[model samples]
Target: MSTRIEVVAGRRRWTVEQKLAILRDAFGPEGSVGDACKRHAIGSGSIYTWRRQAMSGELGGARPAPLPSFAEVELSAPVPGLPTAGSHIEIELPSGVKLTVDSGVDADALARVVAVLTR
Candidate 1:
């Protein structure tokens, strides 16, 4: 008979590459998120968040894209003489904050924007 012992201390940190691999398996045709989560000993929420970050280009990889960043937004009232035309939509947050954005806003960008606004 053989006996082995292992000791673990501190929180586990996952590297970008590891995260990417886990995400690939979680989302791959032959793998499921539940399976990946169990196999990697991580929560589904973490995997989903990593996937979201990966999509927004926060985690660098072969597919390059813009990183999520916050910019100084200047909110001004519409001039009385000017016409509010073209394509624009109003989004009212749960906190009762209204935002006017272009109709063609990117989905990922909009999601990040909404996350910030909600916070």
Candidate 2:
């Protein structure tokens, strides 16, 4: 008696649509790169390659939009007698983008400003 062994050859090909869908899910809330890779049975390297292809317009897929990032703001009790109105927070992004928000600015309005600036 002999045991039979079969070998599979060739890499799995992913469609453009499938790549886009997986990327979208990965960027969605509660989604992560590791989780997406495990769920899709794909490799992290493949995901990066797909992302590069998408960015370079070689994938014929929609380019991933830059997601808005928000930072938590905590207003510590004004130092001694510092006027709150004159107090503003300055945020410097990794891209060297700077944002200054007044202490009394509306939260919603500030978020909108940040969303636009980051994009």
TM-score of 1: 0.45
What TM-scores do the predictions have?
0.45, 0.44
**lDDT score, residue 86, model 1?**
66
Top candidate (TM-score): 1
The backbone clash count of each candidate, in order, is 0, 0
Q: What lDDT score is found at residue 84 in candidate 1?
A: 53
Scored by lDDT, model 2 comes in at 0.76
Error of 1 at 79 (Å): 28
For model 2, the stretches where C-alpha displacement exceeds 4 angstroms are 1-6, 61-119
Which residue pairs of candidate 1 clash?
none
Model 2 TM? 0.44
